[model samples]
Target: MEAGLTERSDEKGEEEYVLLDLDAVMEHVSIRPDTPYVLTGLDTLNPMLIIDGKVKLIGEYEETIGTCLVFSENEAPVLHKETGPSDANLFSGRCIVDPNQVPSKEVKPVARLQKVLKFRLLLDGVDDAQQDHPSTEGNASNQSTATQN
Candidate 1:
């Protein structure tokens, strides 16, 4: 009867419960943990390769929708599409994260990274692209948006 979390017990003397702390009951319980989706080279600024046109990350920070990462030619896998820019200089790849998959310990770090990544958007002339495009005619300064992140 150690302290733990459990669902309501049933009749007929049956008590079904999940062991909250497996470490406390390892001797009696066997549970296989899931493989964590760890991002490679998290220490570096942009650390991941787009394999199969998709990249997953276990992040220490929140990634912005439009914030991008540039990879050298050797870093990224070959892509099959009408290419606008060469992966050789890695003309910036935008980030897309599934918020539901975020780890419990990394919420704050992701938020901070989101802020820093804003500057990268500005430096890449994305701000100018938006301004120059007639489609985005009356929008706020992209520089402000990046700095606000």
Candidate 2:
């Protein structure tokens, strides 16, 4: 995962923004015959909100989240057809494999092989409107009384 923020100056003042990027790879290879697998159910958690500096909310608001998933290989083919000259051509470096390897009978079918690439961008100037509102005088005291259930 990677995160960074950008800052720019306008006639009013300086503004800051944040961006997050994440990449992941998941794979499973089957060693048993006549067993096939399927991949399903991809999900993500909502983004948590963090506030800094002296800012006060005069009203409540909701934010919508977005996500994306990318795959390199979405399906599994027959073992014999899994590799070929085209595969060798696609390799960027040397390829090595054991010639006398034996398949394990206990191996189960692979159900999922996936690659996920994601990014989250916080919209610009979200707090600008709030800056116009008057700060809550007792916000600090109220925050201290909220219990952590």
Candidate 3:
């Protein structure tokens, strides 16, 4: 892949992956304060492997669902002096982000099929015979089958 500053890098070879400046990436992804974004496709030997930054979450790409991108990775090791409940505390309030990961240079991700999460929606009383749903013309395949009771 060409360098990050190239104007047509996204259109060139390895089109699915394009190097972009931090500002350009931020423009495409609107991030709110303190919200953690699970970035997928980082395991594809991208140059970002050795970049200096704090990583809240990272994963390998699994598949796309609804408008969301899915990913999977093993649980990260707990950071030193974790803020969560003590082992003595059985009931937990909420999980905190206090995990440690080896430096990217030291860790080379292996390409393999992860024991990924499979999800499904269970809706009762859904029948196709009485179906009449409103759907937009464009991007019909992306839309879900609307159910009526």
Point to the candidate with the largest lDDT: 3
Best by TM-score: 3
Any residue pairs clashing in model 2, and if so which?
none
Cα displacement (Å) at residue 142, model 2: 2.7
lDDT of 1: 0.26
> How far out, in Å, is residue 29 in model 1?
36
Give the per-residue lDDT of model 3 (tens digit) for 103-125. 22222222222222221221344
Ranking by TM-score: 3, 2, 1
Would you estimate the TM-scores of all the predictions?
0.15, 0.15, 0.17
Predictions in order: lDDT: 0.26, 0.26, 0.29
Greater-TM-score candidate between 2 and 3: 3
Relative to the true structure, candidate 1 reaches a TM of 0.15
131 Cα displacement, candidate 1 (Å): 38
- Segments of candidate 3 deviating more than 4 angstroms: 1-11, 17-52, 65-149
